[model samples]
Target chain A: MNRKKLLSGVLAVCIAAATALTSAACAKKNNKDSGGDTAEVKKLFVDLHTLMPSASENATPDQPHPVNASRYIAAAYKSLTGTEIVWASDYAKPTDNINNISAWFNQQINIKNCPAIGFTFGTKMQADGLYADLGEYLERPNPYVAGNTRWKDIFEDWVWDDPAVTDANGKIVSVPIVLHPGSATAIYYNKDMFAENGMTVPTTWNEFIKTIDDGKKVPGIKYPYVPYTGDTGISLSSWAFRYSLSPGFAAHMADRTDYDKNGIVSTNELIRAVLEGAFNPNVCQEAKALYRLAYNYYKTVLPGGWESITDTTYLNAWDEGKVAMKNQGLWYYTNEKSDVIRKFDFDLFAPPVAQSDSSAYASDLPRKKLSEGYRSQVLISFNVMLPAVSGNEKLLEKAIDFLMYLSAPEAVTAMVQENGAGLPAVKGAEYPSVYDDSAWLDREFTEIGISEWPLGFIEGNTANINAAFSDWVFGEKTEAEFFTIVNREQVNGARTMVNNMKINTAGWNI
Target chain B: MKDGKKRKIQIKYIIAAALVSVFSLFYLFDFLWAKTYKVEVVSVSDENPVASNGERVEIAVRVTHFGKPANGHVIFALPSDGRMLAFTTLTDENGVATLTYIPYTANAFLPVHDVEIRIRDQSNSIFWEINAYTDLELKMRAR
Candidate 1:
């Protein structure tokens, strides 16, 4: 009886000690002061590093409009936060790897004496556990969170859950500031060349192949079609696969698939078909086609390309009597608006959709994730983060307010008027005027629009896609061989991505 | 001989006097017979003399001859720029003229001054003018 009593006494002491330690671990920091003025809030510092294309020494003033994502985001954030933000611009840095970034972050954090929010194209820091868990902010009512009803409601219902932001891991880590939607890949033929030879837009996969083959029979033309090789080539060919595999891609992402489901059909067959259809002999056949089409189309249509050409020259071929079309994004409006090309009086339209009962039309898939261009090639693309460095509540509030402003009709109108950004994620913001001055482009989309989701932006899916594309384009792999590699890569990459992403599924009743 | 010379000079003076009298009568008839016209101007909303804050200002002008209304081009000009702002027509039968001028907010970048309306007719070589003023006093409501 005495031994039992001693054991009970020891257990009680142990319980007390455990409770004391637990309390200490869970203790909240004293964020508030007696005066209610509060503790000195630390300033959150952020660095928006972005790439800008530089002009060559002999380049004319008409260089391509460089994407200043960081600048626009910073302006909007500053307008909303009303915080005096100090910024540093890093020009022409090629390597976007997280390890390279971590070194920069460590250096900045130590020197600046502030917890830094590195506003990058991806969640490199967050995946590394260098950034805060934005999950807490999403749980509470916060405007910066993308999927919140108050905020996400402003965007189209389709975009609210664009696959770009929702990877296989189901977490949105980077915030896409500018979202370029639809496959910018379209077959642009020499209008005069096609007209002189009697050609039209191909609607079916079979027609597409036959047309290219027929074009090659012409004596003067080098190849019926040319396609980009290496990275560029793969991206273009991938679009062909993307459209063909749209239904399965959408189905699998919708969480309707089983583990045993082989969603991909004829992955290798499709790759071989695109390669054969392209009809170009060279490795970088696509880009060469673009350049050739520009020159040939210019000789007939526009008076200009007789001189050396720039990127605008490629776009002008479509407008100024060169090429009949070019596969590019809606933001190609900027390219069309270029001083020399503006005379062409261009129009916008969606690429032809392969007939599918299961695939949702592009118009139906309203929401798009703003992913980086390179990565979105393989996986989902989107933007999904808020900067944590500013630390100023007002700044954060203002940033949220700017997003709210983005939802406003006036803000959308301004963006459209400037021809600055691409599609807005908001509902009712879709209008004909958003694309071209013509009602036809708008009408075309209305007639045949399909549901679309932007790919994941933050994670390493971009690298995976690029790798897969490289193997398909340059590597000596059969169509079956290429697809096998692609599927394996997707499965392995997806698992790693989900493991890194911390998803918050609160209030998701569905 | 002197008497005969004086009589001839008197005949020449009489011929010169007759020509001057005819020219004076012609000038008087032309001035008195020229066409004259008046323009009647009013706001579209009779109940409102002043524009409701953020509302458009509607002005109407009419032209008539011998109490029968006429229809032709009417030029409306603003006092600030002295450029014709708008051109419209009077009703074919009623000769009623109307144009809307949206009032600007005090903070907005629009000229605040008197607006002028002028009407001209090719049928009678007659023209008429009218003027209206807006103070632009209040803050506008959010759009």
Candidate 2:
């Protein structure tokens, strides 16, 4: 009995010790993740690619990792996925204006070999069949985005409508990482000149133009306003001038809506009316009012010698304080510190409503409040794609899986803040104050303005449109001649757009 | 006394004396030699981040010894009578010591500045003398 009692005590002790150790281990494992045991994770072998080659590519054995933004992203990705990213520095940035990343696809680098690719807003070889039809991949539920929200639903719908991203079949071919492609025009006024002349930033459109003419009276002011007509990208005050003249043109340009059926007479319907000869230059009351407004813009507002100067010259003249007011985009003067010093501590100017009478339009323009038409169209740019060359039966899904990780809103926004020059398409991206101001992102297009999309669509591009518009501004083209040319240009694009209208059948019936 | 009895007592006394001496020497050597430690002020960019007055700023620090992460508690001695986010904090597994500093006012004159740091022993006593240098700058401008 004594031996049996002793054996029982030893057995109890051993069991207690084992139970204590198992409980301790279970506790340690539970502590590893605070959220839950629902830690579903996948391993990735495909390397993260970058737009620029890693700086350490050609290093002579004594180099640290390339200190660019991609390196940080690679580190974060490894932490998330437990995989190493391959840095291909031999594939450098676009040399001689040729994108080597795209060239690789053209070169037919095996899709299994090409992991991840990034490029700016331009020709993405979608037509060449080099790009994967990313719509299905984007539509899949993103594992990173907390719950059921698909990746496609993250960005604004209007972004995919860009004629650049949509193929002939009306499918969105790319996934954009950065949104702000081009800059919106804002007035930068010389504070010293304004203070000296007792001139304040104008609230009304007529006063704003009058201030420009009156600003020359300030000391050392030659051209009171620097309008760089030579810059083809700039539409010679088109934001304030042209957009205000006709608001909401892009929305209804190809809409199949009938007039008099609805209260809202869209800008495109009015353009269609003009095309149908409903608004002529001379005879019709509506046509005469529109013509008179265009006449006043050319005659009174435009600087006579603007067509002679180049964009660089105009900006240089502004920098020297030879001008009182200069208008440019957020990206125009990148170095804010020097721009403020050179331009006499300039301040932002709110644009006054276009002084052109909206009531004069019998269907040409919308008679709306300044607040209703105050927004600007932001150019959504940049996309990353898993090329179609990687057949789905193969590791295309794996490449796409890695892409989903890299392009997660959190991941992409971090990259934009660290590396990209413009705004992020992902929500909650904080602007680095050193590079950009948070306020410049705010602006609403009062009118549904047409993008420079057709310029990319039409064969020869926007230079022709730029030259023709410049000619009209300088009287190189007569009023009758300019109207005829612009009208013909729109009619030509309308044919192609109307056909694609079948595939993208949902939006505004256009 | 018998010879055997005397020999036994002598051996016991000798063994006791050697043990006392060995213990004294062991403690003395511990008091004499010093262990090496490494503390680095991580490189920060020119946008020396500083919060506007009435706001706060947090900075992280790392502690290491013999090329390995140094664990346990650490104390930071801030410059200009400035206080730390924590008077005392423990180092993470990676040896990162997060220390926050809030300036009542922003001074851009010297963007780069320094903070002093040291390690504490198990009993929370200062175990090491700190190496001081200008590794930090007040690059933080008034927001």
Candidate 3:
């Protein structure tokens, strides 16, 4: 009886295997008969990062939905090609740590079930050969876009040179979908609170400080000013403060550091300048004055326990009338409007300039008018990339096709409107009326384009740099102690970057 | 013959005892580890009754579980009107989550709007499948 049972089990296994093979063959034959394009590329898995809504939301037009750009873009793609988008539900959630998401994508790419299309915050993945080079494809015409000869022609010229989308080898590894034309960061203040204090929008650093001091006197306000103390890296508040002040102090270093003679300063050039002793944060009086001014301003306005506040907490405080003013990216305008329960009236203003009265280091240069040269710290938004790990040629082609469709003017406008963030990167796309404020148009005076400078060195050391600055500002460490720690870290960070990128620094007479 | 029969009986008893131990472990694991959690929406209130278009109206919600406040949970609030955007916020230590809503277009008169609120875990998974609602009046034009 045991022998017979074993034989039957073996026979069943053999029959199952045969049936699977036959079914696969039949399906392939049927696909060929029906024009196999659809069969080969039935679905594409995508992770649009923060641009798309959460899959768990199950958002639809029938209900009050957050702008579901992924759904809208998917529908348009489906109409153009008979393919479906399987939104990568398990990857790149808005709340997930960006570093973790990038690491997860790197690991997932080795598996068979990796997403065909995804996004990365930096170009490290492209450097690792994880993303497909789109240089050739960009030269091809986008069929969906009317009168477009080349796909790359649709975007702003600066986008091609932006280090975020392009790799060091000059390969286009990612597509730029959005651009921040003017000031990316601003102060969102409570209009009612300002009115009660008889305060008007401040254009100079002294006026801004006075507004904060006055707002502190109000009975209901717990924190008169809350600069976003969230992530240790370049945050909304810190970036705004650094760039707005750095121009007045560090603008003189621009001509010496911009090695390539390009209008903008690249990471390598800044690193080289640091090594050559052209710019030193440890001893330079201008640099010291910049930090001193910033420290004093933050020390005066920031409330106790401010160091513990994240973006969410600060925004919550602002919504609850606990905060009178908070620094945030322009994206918060649409974000605030979408809130169904926000009770206070609020408006945005540019970060006030540090005038000569505030500091001797401050330049008397006029604020730069709206121009293409003065771009946001985040040069590009919605950085879509095609991962090479998917390995299927047909699937990758379909992914690229869908990206082309998204790049068209109509689709780009829809996405920008839904995102409520930066302006459109593509020309001919309609500018969202929500970002029409004139305050965002005029740039800061002596606005040095290298906003991240010494503070934003190699990615690994940025957190330490930010922490040391926070410690000094919050009274945990003295100014001298803070400078000692940051100076060493910044030099080491620049050296590490130089070595990793194999930058040729022999020309520099260090 | 008696010894052989005794050995067989001993083997059968060993097998039965092992099976019983495994079953008990399974039962204990279920009872001690997988306890079910309950979430309740205590209240949803409108902070502003006389809000207008382009002006913000505050919406607040309090969540609890078995009479204890739930902290750090996420709440997604959506207005009944499909044109306006939905908002999400986190409940504080006191189990309260508040967000500000503003209408884009103005109306001639004040209109009552109902907001649908859903509570979820920090990872964004729905905890209470059922949604709660609150109503408020907005003038739809600046006063």
Candidate 4:
């Protein structure tokens, strides 16, 4: 009996020790305090791929990441909302295919529990069911929320209130977060060169081309103007198309209920004009000449390897007095900071309007006063999702509050503080103090701000535009062939994608 | 005294100490490697603001380390002035600009427009205010 009792005691002790250890190990696994577990404040991951990759680790304030605007948003969230937001530069891998970002997002962010917010180019962010309806969160009656003028009115008109656009169930799904307005399509010129050369700022299309050719003849001047067509591939083409159809394209696209409608009033007409003016070699003979002049200038005027030179290189060439005029985006100044700007004055003008008349530049002088319009990028309400598994309501609320704070007047100002670098989506938000006191405020922030366009269609057609432009640039297809391909193939492809996705196909009927 | 156990404990202590030292050294190297650069803005033009004959313009700029300029090429571009009236120039070691005139009328130049300027390198970049130095208000006076 004594031997048996001793044996039983030892077995009980062993079992108890094992049970205690197993419980302890499980507890350690559940511990949120350690970096390894998820139970503590669940970590939400954000991937900011819109910026170029940085090789640096400890990205500082002054020497902040190249995408400091995004970093500023993250930092501001931590300070204003008091939420712990951590972001890793390496969160996105090389092969993170943007096409199926919804699936990629589901895998990387583990949206079943933690909520996350981020900015991406239009194509990737629009993938299906990757977001939650932020309408209720955005419309809540907080004063700070209501006072943010930028989005208050814009949301109803452009963002959530669009009748044509609907989510998976035909409900509003994604919210506009950061908008990059189409780089305003305008003509950039050298004032000193124009004056000295007796060149009038070309107001009509004929005059503009004549002015360019005329400027080429002036003694010692390289060329009156050089569009950086060689440096920027589709961007130059996009600029060309916009200038060709600027006056009526927006309205036609905006009210485009019947996609196949004809005449100058139709979107197809505008698209056709762009196709002919840009891609139709026979029609755009003059346009092609303009493009050739631009490319030739890049080859002859720009130093060293013109093909490898960046946008800034051509811009610097302009600054160095190597070229006379460059047709480019407004960010040209913000992108290339050279003292040449001070030495020589430059100005923005609407591209000379095209006309059917032979003396287009002569009689159509009044129409020339109308400059090109700006394309807008907006900051719409960001989408925040509560994982069905982690359904942590507290975390959801915190993220919503963070967005609210970001939309606040003060916060908008803080973000816009980086002048020419960014603008806010908040409507009626006072111009940033940088602009508040300056005369250029309207031109820099207001006039240049990205305006909302037909969002869904724009997002859908981005790839088609890319492919079409690529083929046209490398001469794989003639301009007319390219246009037909873009219209019939690209736009039609987009229409098919929308139909397959069960998206509304009214405006794309053509 | 129990010599065997004592010797074993001493060995363990030495191992822990060496491990800690390695980690500290690793951290020190990373911190040193990530040191911030003292980026200074240099002029790309031979003149702070170059003069022009109303036609051709040229300018130059460079990046330097410890007062010795780096050999990398740099850019100097002009901002738009509403009328597309301005041209830009790229710079070499010392930025210089020259402009010849085609003799347009006097109303061409707008007064007091703002010029935008920017520069960048491998690690960091800088944006400068150049209107602080040059006048953008010059008008095309009829010769």
Task: Tell me how many clashing residue pairs each candidate has.
Answer: 52, 18, 13, 80
Task: Sort by DockQ, best first.
Answer: 3, 4, 2, 1
* Residue A56 lDDT in candidate 2: 52
Best by DockQ: 3
lDDT of all predictions: 0.37, 0.46, 0.60, 0.41
User: Quality of candidate 4's docking, in CAPRI categories?
Assistant: incorrect
Better of 2 and 4 by DockQ: 4
How big is the positional error of residue A287 in model 3, measured in Å on the Cα after superposition? 3.3
Candidate No. with top TM-score: 3
What RMSD, rounded to one decimal, does every model reach?
Answer: 23.9, 22.6, 12.2, 16.0
DockQ of each: 0.01, 0.02, 0.09, 0.06
lDDT of 3 by residue, A6-28 (tens): 99999999999897676455434
Q: How close is candidate 4 to the true structure, as a TM-score?
A: 0.52
Residues B1-143, model 4: lDDT tens digits: 59999999999999999988887776665444323322233322222221211222122334444544444323322222111122333333433223211111111121232333332233223322111123222232223
Report the poorest 10 consecutive residues by lDDT, candidate 1 chain A: A27-36
Off by more than 4 A, model 1: A1-82, A85-149, A167-197, A204-206, A218-324, A337-348, A353-409, A427-434, A445-484, A502-510, B1-143
